[model samples]
Target chain A: MTSIATAGASVTEQHAAIAGARPWQRLVLLAVGLLVALGLPWFVYPPVAMDIAAWALFAVALDLLLGYCGLLSFGHAAFWGGSAYATGLIAIHLGVPFPLAVLGGAVFAMILAVPIGYLSVKRSGIYFAMVTLAFAQMLFFIANQASSLTGGENGLQGVPRSFFGIEAVETDAFFFYYAALPIILLGMWAAWRIVHSPFGRVLVAIRDNAPRARALGYDVERYKLIVFVLSAGLSGLAGGVFAVSHGFVALPELHWTTSGEVVLMTVLGGIGTLWGGVIGAGLIVMLADYLASSGFDGIGIVTGGVFVTVVLLFRRGIWGTARHLWLNRKRS
Target chain B: MTSTTPTPRCALRTEGLTKDFRGFRAVSSVDLEVAEGTVHALVGPNGAGKTTLFNLLTGFLKPTSGRIMVFGDDVTGMAPERITHRGVARSFQITSLFENLTPREHVEIALQGLTNQGLRFWRSEKLLGRRRDEVDRLLAEVGLTELADKPTGLMAYGQKRALELALVLAVEPKLLLLDEPTAGMGIEDVDRTIELVRRIAEGRTVVFVDHNMHVVGQLADRVTVLQQGSVLAEGPYDEVRADPRVITAYLGEAHSA
Candidate 1:
């Protein structure tokens, strides 16, 4: 306990000492980030840029649970894929507009999340992860077997991007990119808002010391369940958007690997920092794109190598480490 | 002798509070009562069920067979958080804290819990700015104003205990269960903690378990000594300390000399 306290104290002191950069500096950084995000499609494939934005939103959703709530979910793809299927089914069957379809999908994911989170939040750490994974795998099997509804193993295809009677996004890549940006940005902002709220502070308190939080009259499990559902809703929203943008929802979206990928994105960018998810997602997506285009078949090996290096050397992932160094330098 | 009538002055009471772990009988049919606004101390040699009994009272553990009442309300088998909502709060023996959070944030979060706004994900924590003065007062009460902005993980051992006290106080609890608040503190730290407890115990009921005889001697208005699982003796510190069973329990027959 003493050793932990000493180490924590030093880390705290370091953060305090390097409380550098004013509010305007952060605003400028945000502006630069927005410009980069908006301008990226001109330099790269527009669809790829859209994929990064969608995945970044997905990563942020997972971070709400993993980072703020201190829950490590290994089966978030259940919500992601589950929402993708829901959005596709809604758009195809009901002929609803894209935004409403996405909302329907997100709401469906949240409904699924309620029971899953209820049972899963009962356990924590690896057990919690395993329970969520079990439920997700169950959903994956159902999606596979209900082929008529989900298109089964063949995947759900031809999810239209008709936003309020405008079908321009189907042929124009830039239109699709612009349509997806606001949704992704809104999802990210909501996540940011949650983490900075009183509710978010309690979630952090729970993550730090659940027993203490309980002793202080916070229903720790209830808080966890709420965050879990919120995370699933956000992930579902992202997945819904992705399904519409890509015009397909496949079985791979529900697979465990997809869940693992988001975890990697969160950790690689920096856990707990909101924007770290975006940076991490951008890096991974761009890297994978670059690798595939360059005829490099070992993208897994390269991604794994980067993950290992970041874990060992930076410990805070790419953005967190960079922020730490920047703050320290500013302090000096 | 158990009283038939529930006294408003009695802040906490337990009847036949028995707990068994695989038939090990950690605590057996113990009846305990604490009056309002007094510093009550539970002490025993190791494995005397001090911690277990504390857990049972604070709703951390369910008694195998018994009833726990706080201020005339049956709180037995209630959830810990429910118990806290009924004006009971506790500090852990191991110094539990939100290590990554600052002392100010810790107090703020605790204060937020009191406002029942802990689940408000849509509202900014800045809305809690209305409670900033209260947060500062708590930090100052714990003598942590200077270090309020420092992360609790970085706090010194004594400071952590103080922070824990402030966190408990933030709940505005009528009863504070402090488990070994001065367990591993140095003399100065111990003295400071005792003083802090003394100041806080003025209007609150404090039921603490302490291994430190000096702290118990200084602060405890009443002392209960346990041997094995049952109460060995109960009285003011001098009388309990003078009990032959307690003496035998502590030093065995050799030290009874």
Candidate 2:
């Protein structure tokens, strides 16, 4: 987000240089992204499209903390999987509408984030990552032992998608995608709005130099905690949606590897670019889906290879490097 | 240098300030008092606890045992931000800035800090434009108006220092603690900074640490010499400069160099 625009630079030039798109260009990009999101179900399986939407939201939420706030959370699965289980339980027992369940799940995630973020934000860098990971692992074990509530290894099965009791909506994949798209998009828009707001600017400053931020009379810890909670809430939203989409909540969702996978997706797309997560999620999810369909069991090998290539070739991830190129092109 | 009247109000006073780091007493019991609207320079040899004293006053480091009073308000052991809210602002000896941010953004952030809107996440950054005139004035005050849009990472050391000064000035602080304000500056930049400091020190109490005797001689109304974390001498620049102990402790090294 730190654009290297000099004095007297035009707004478009500055935007293009700093963010890789001007206002109109961004609108165009948004339009293209929307079209792809809408059309993906037609090209791929509708279930896969829903997965993309859900995972994209997940990556974007993670990016809010990792990219904008300079926090790397290695245990975000606690929020995602924890929410998935919550949404499942809420839907199963309460028989509420899936939207309400999702909302409840998101809130639960935020509540979970409070203590986790409070402790984790105090330690930075790898320690922050480790603290978050430890919390997620603890949750994973709790869910494992509480088989009666969580369905144990079998996972929470048959989470009903009660779209106001609409019969066709639950059975139809395309309908469900459209239904979940709004929530995912809303979450994404909120992330965009947050990173673009004055609060986000402070987050960027905190990420860049926290001590400087604190010295500037900002409560740096407070800012980190708030962002951490926000990110967890958004991640919970994505997880709740995913659980509803798949009609099941599995133990793997809360696993450390799932956390690692989302991190990989975020890095592949672009770390700080809010939209980059969507692209990264699209690639990884689609690749995994394709590999699964083709009976290729080595999904990790291929994804890991792709990740290495992206890190080596595109140090700024796909979108950041693209923005760099665009800026250089404009400069030249 | 303006001489204080009898019993001038203290802008900042430390009653036996002390800080111990893992058995090393970086700062021992030191009583420091700065009269209102005057520049006080803390001159000491390397590792003489000048920076440590600044840190304690600013609440970056909690004092081991003592009281820090800013404008007669007890501020000891308070957080740095709280200390700032009490009209005290500090600049680091090492320039600490958001490297990815522009000078304009830095000034805006600092200006935003003075009000209630800085923590508002829902509002657009456009709201900061209401203080555009103030931001521009501060930028112009520090001669950063032309380069305000440039990222600080791309800025020259002198320009970055100037921007840092602008940020500090934007706070409109009552008591300004500048740790090595002129450190790592070119000669022209140092002269410019001295002039800028002189201009801004009119209505504020300034405490600073500097090695350049010329800068201290030109700016400080009074000098406090420290040695091994204790106050050695305190007086006007000429008197302290000529003090035998002060010479043996600090200025002697400078004269030799």
Candidate 3:
């Protein structure tokens, strides 16, 4: 029954001490970003910032399961798209308040994520990723087949933004950005807190050494399943926001293409950097918009070519690259 | 928690443990009994199913037949983690430390076990002071205190062995199974490790696999020699080492002492 402190006086206690500091810093950065976002629409378009907010939340959710738990789910579009459909469906039919409809849609998306995440949890690595993809494809078909309910391939349209009785839609475009910005920032901040907590450390440990984590008396699979579901539920949260912001729920959002796009955003931002997901989402959304307007039907060609270049050289993404440069400069 | 009674003396026992991989026998019908408060050594040539037997005992590999008893509870086919929970900790023949993490963090994960808080995330780490104390003590025991914060990949040959032992020690098990605890250490590290293993585990049962005969003689109270897939010899260190059978297994011929 020897204690850890008495045993290793020389193994410096800096790891946790250093890692724990990042969270408070993240919170500060999030507060600053939220403030800027609140006023962003006065300068730029509100819809653009709102789009970035939704996509940012989506990328953060993806990173939670991918960066922390090490589950590479390529089929997350099922939940994201499903949530969009759910959000739109509830708003159009039930005429619930806009936030409540989004919440309902996200909950429905979570319902979908449960079974798929459950079966996929039994697998690991590429097999787990592929299994999720397969299940998502099945969902894509269900969205297609249930055209009457889902509005099919063409998608359900004219979703309304009721803005919690603000009558903001009648006021100006700036309304939705301020509303959605707080939630996305809060979501990212919450993600930071979870990943840095003892729980988050265990997830990283599970990812790196599952057998060891199991040996440490952790039901590693249970932790993985919980995170998987939570991340999916959050993605649904983001998707609900998307449908509310755009006033439409479409089939294309649920496609594997959308899943691939999120993955690319996460990777292109650098895998596990704290704000990397948000930054990645911003760049990708902006880049897609730029490419489409420039008459480049081959945005894929341009983006894919850039993706290859990034992976080949700066595999760490933007934040990672910045951190590395900071540390390297400090050292030299 | 030192036992007041004359240390049970019958800590871990195995009865007819067997394993088969696709109709090929890896380990068959092996019985091993180890007393409490003693360092028992297992010595065998390579491919003697020593690692396989370790796996069966630790619940990493299921026995096709037979039973494993720890403090007389039948733990034969239980999962590895469950077995670990039942006061049996192990080190793999191949090192199993978290490669991406520093050794200190690796040991903290182990210390978390000692704290009885595997899933407690909301509590402040300040509450884990006692567990952290034990982890540091074990690291110091293995002489790994100096290199603890370094990544496990940065560990030197003998230090890695010591770290592995500390990982198992984190659980402070009643019975410890070590696969090749000294398989790849230089002379200096091997001697340091042998002393360290004997010191902290003074009253615990230790079943370790080793290839060095001198190490067995110096450390073991009883020795079991495995050859191929069966027990070649089992007795006191001198008795087994002196046996013509064990000599033949090691030297490929019989010689009297």
On DockQ, the leading prediction is 1
Poorly placed runs, candidate 1 (over 4 Å) = A1-10, A13-21, B1-8, B253-257
Per-candidate DockQ values are 0.69, 0.50, 0.32
lDDT of 3: 0.76
Off by over 4 Å in 3: A1-44, A169-172, B1-10, B114-116, B120-131, B253-257
Give candidate 1's chain B TM-score.
0.94
TM-scores vs. true structure, each candidate: 0.94, 0.95, 0.89
lDDT of 1 by residue, A114-205 (tens): 99999999998789989999998998899899998888999998887877756676667788888778888888889988988899889878
Distance from true location, Cα of B92 in model 3, Å? 2.0
- The lDDT-based order of candidates, best leading, equals 2, 1, 3
Candidate 2 Cα outliers beyond 4 Å, as residue runs: A1-16, B1-6, B255-257
User: Model 3, residue A169: what's the lDDT?
Assistant: 56
Task: Tell me the TM-score of model 3.
Answer: 0.89
**What is every candidate's alpha-carbon RMSD to the true fold?**
2.9, 3.8, 5.5
Q: If you superpose only chain B onto the true chain B, what TM-score does each candidate give?
A: 0.94, 0.95, 0.89
How well does candidate 1 score on lDDT at residue A226?
A: 96
